[model samples]
Target chain A: MAMLTDLLVISAANRIIGLIRDVFVALDPDTAQAVEVLLYFLVMVLYAILCELLLNGQTLGKRIFKLRVVDASGLRLEPSQVIIRNLLRLVDGLPMFYLLGGITCLLNTRMQRLGDIAASTVVVRIPEVSHPDLDNVLGSKYNSLLEHRHLCARLRQRVTPEVAAIALEALTRRDRLDPVARLKVFAGLAAHFRELVDFPAAATESLGDEQYVRNVVEILYRAG
Target chain B: MLIDLPRFVNAERPHWQALEAILKRFENDPDLRLPIDEAQRFHYLYQRTGSALSRISTFASEPELKQYLEWLVSRAYSIIHGQAERRRFHPWRWFTVTLPTTFRRRIQAFQMSLALTVLGALFGVIALAIDPEAKSALMPFSHLTGRPSERVAQENADRGKRLEGRKTTFSASLMTHNTKVAIFTMGLGISYGLGTIVLLFYNGVILGAVAFDYVMDGQTIFLLGWLLPHGVIEIPAILLGGQAGFIIAHALIGWGDRRITRAQRIREAAPDIVTIIAGAGVFLIWAGIVEAFFSQYHEPVVPYGIKIAFGCVEFAGLIFFLWKGGANSEQNNSSKA
Candidate 1:
């Protein structure tokens, strides 16, 4: 993605240079060439700066990859910070090919390059988020656990958020699991929940391990 | 400790939405400054939302709600605690007030940069004086390998004609190359000052060796004419680069207060480092133009005395600028008082 960003920036710079040169056809050949080189350098330096600023801390490449440059302190990135970090590319590119920058990034705890350290910026990946479809997973099944309101309340209280999440995930992904693994997972979850809250023998005797787990999930997620 | 996840989310969703709306405004337009009442309301929403997130954090059901609240609280925390404000930039004030003031503030780093260069220059002079055979090794450039007298004669004979058609190209190359060197010098400060020191010293060595060789060959007038016009600005620009580098090194080393973290120190020094380097870059551009267009013309085409005088004037102007450029600004006055 970084390399792709570099290629896009270079291509854009070359196109701009060509357009400018065409407009100034009467210029001396050496002077024209000088302008091209100077413009190329300027564009190369400013490309990231402009893109990051205008696009909310993302270059074209970073945007494509859902990566962003943010303030390491968890604040909004300041313009001066942007300029300082980008300018430090001169040092990062030192000895050639960003070797120095790459080494510094590897050594640093936050994976920040020298430029990032100086500027107090960090590049982070933005994860894609969507609400889990609870209705689809926990259908309107006849939950025998809901019959004992007292035990259902107790079960919700005793179950930790982490444990609840694991149960929910297991139920949601049950189809993807093999039959033996699926049975084993439900057995484990039912045992854990059963220990947390004891339902009566009448509520337990008729329910299979899978159906028992499903009833618990529905009770935990849905209201009567 | 018990949480009714649906009821809790239902009660707090409006506050979370309000806070998100405010944050979206800040994010979309970083320079936006809210009115006092609006700002207070924003603060209220953040605190309220934060309180709600803490309550639901331990709840077992509704992981999606927990994640959403965590995201909101994190954004609010960043916005509320951020030290830097997005202000409009004024270039004239930056050059006159900010640049010189920053230079004055970080003068110690500049002094260290100067000291290292001088020490390196002294080393170069002694080494060359003792072993003239090391001239080729000391001066890496092919043009500088020959005797100074011969090079001066060749330059005089050309009378600036050598750069007639390609002056702009030469100038552009000089500007870009010198600017890169300056930036590289400053960037090396990340090495905790070691790399910066070595680079500055190496630069001084080359300068000293070349000057000594020219003076010894009885071509002092020609050398001065050739170098002074651009050297006056170019040398100081390089020094500014060194100065910025030393500043970074000092911050990393925590030379002063032990209480401040490395990140805080670097953050505080960032604006000044940027100011000095930008100033150096501007100076280099001017020096590049002068070196290609004016310094190359020697003897009959452009007299040595005029070139030397021009360099002196430039030196004086630069010193005056750095010493007292923004001394009378309103902000400076208020600070002084």
Candidate 2:
């Protein structure tokens, strides 16, 4: 998708170059042709270099794909790295399209093409995280699990933070889940939490699996 | 370790934010340097943020918060730990000093490049002498494959009128094409120098075949006049490209030193490789202009002696520049030390 978008952009730039060439061609044919060829190659080569340099290692394609080129050694991207890598498109784009690059990427552990290997850079997905509204997810509704103080304390102690976090995430994103998926997920969570501690029948019997998880999260998060 | 998560975040958030802002400034301007006090402060913030991350990493219930802290620590870590020098660029210093210094440092590779080309040229001369028909295959261009005397007659008769209107376009094409070839030749180093060797030898073969063809046809003056002006610079530029390729190959093969890994060796040589290739590119551009505007014109229009003299002068200048251009600076630095 990024390659397509970049190609489209290059095509549009070529059209503009053509228009500019027409004006020059009327005055000096040789100069016009020279300008056209120079401009064409410049646009093709500089597209990635300029974008990666100015945009913090993100080209238009990389931006669209939510990917960024970063130094494999976790250093700032140097100008030399950007230039050397882009110049290497000559080899990476061998035979036809990026067949050589693609195969190299697949075979390599870090999935770096020849350019990336030479430049010491890697393309990484920019992870996006949505902060959950803790207040809304764990509202003031009375938590039945909290009624049995001893069992609630044990549940909190036994449930690893990872499990507790997963439960919170499910509750926070519950509205976006499919009905069947929601039921299955909540059922699984409730079963896992139940095995951690034995809450009396009265505390959990009236609560549904989803509500039971809501009660468990409140106990884990809110101290009595 | 089981501290209050809310209080912990409240206490550390400001430091994390401070580190992020500093990192942003560093990333935006690579050449930016901080005062000693500010540098100390930056280090403090990084350490504090890293500590917070360790604390939060264990209590991983707040996935989003942990992710944010991890991101901050990572960005800070890179800024602090990167080993590549980030000095501000000075084009004059690079062209006169750094470029020559790097070339001289890798002189052996350049010699290897020269040897390979010479070897290939010898092969071409021998093969063509054995079978004259091989000229068609050896020098494939239509203009080149024909009899040299006929071509010289044609060039002298036309006196560059054939290229009168298209010189600029021709120059641009040459610059772009040669620059592309130079870069590709350097890049092929990743193929363990095998590809670079093949390309350099192939170029030499073409050069040898053409030289032999002209000499045999008794058009040596015309041939030298035509090739010398541009070939002096252009051939060396390509050799520089080959030199870079061999540098990369040497680093890959570890150069018989296992104290460092292949990656470290490549990383160490990368800056020099770029420097040599860029120098080659600059040379090729000049060669291109010369080839189009000056080399193409022949005897009656522009004398062969003048062209040959110009080429010799250019070659001498190039050798002197490579050998001693940066020597003064080296002496000053050593004396100061």
The best candidate in terms of TM-score:
1
Per prediction, the TM-score for chain B is 0.95, 0.96
Candidate 1: pairs in clash: none
Residue-by-residue lDDT tens digits, candidate 2, B1-337: 4555566677788888898899889867777788989999999998998888787665435556767777777777877876636777788999999999889989999998999899889888888999999999998798888888998999999988988899999999998899888988899988889999999999888888889889999999998899999999999999999999898788878777779877667667888998999899899989999999999999799999999999999999999999998988878977999
Best by lDDT: 2
Comparing to the true complex, what docking class would candidate 2 get?
Answer: acceptable
How much is A191 displaced in model 1, in angstroms? 2.8
Candidate 2 off by > 4 Å? A133-140, A144-184, A196-206, A216-224
lDDT of 1 by residue, B1-337 (tens): 6655667778888888999899889878777788999989989998998888787666566566677777777777777787647568899999988899889889999998889888888888988999999898888999988988888888889988998888888999999999989988898888898989999999999988988998999999988888989999999999999999998888889876569887777777888898999999999999999999999998888999999999999999999999998888846678889
lDDT of model 1 at residue A147? 84
Candidate 1 lDDT over residue span A1-224, tens digit each: 76577677779779989888777647678878789879988887788888888887888888888888888877767776787788888888868988989999999998999889878889887655566677888777777778887777677767787888888899899999999999999999999989988999998899888888888877676643
Instruction: Tell me the lDDT of model 1 at B247.
Output: 89
The DockQ of each candidate is 0.55, 0.47
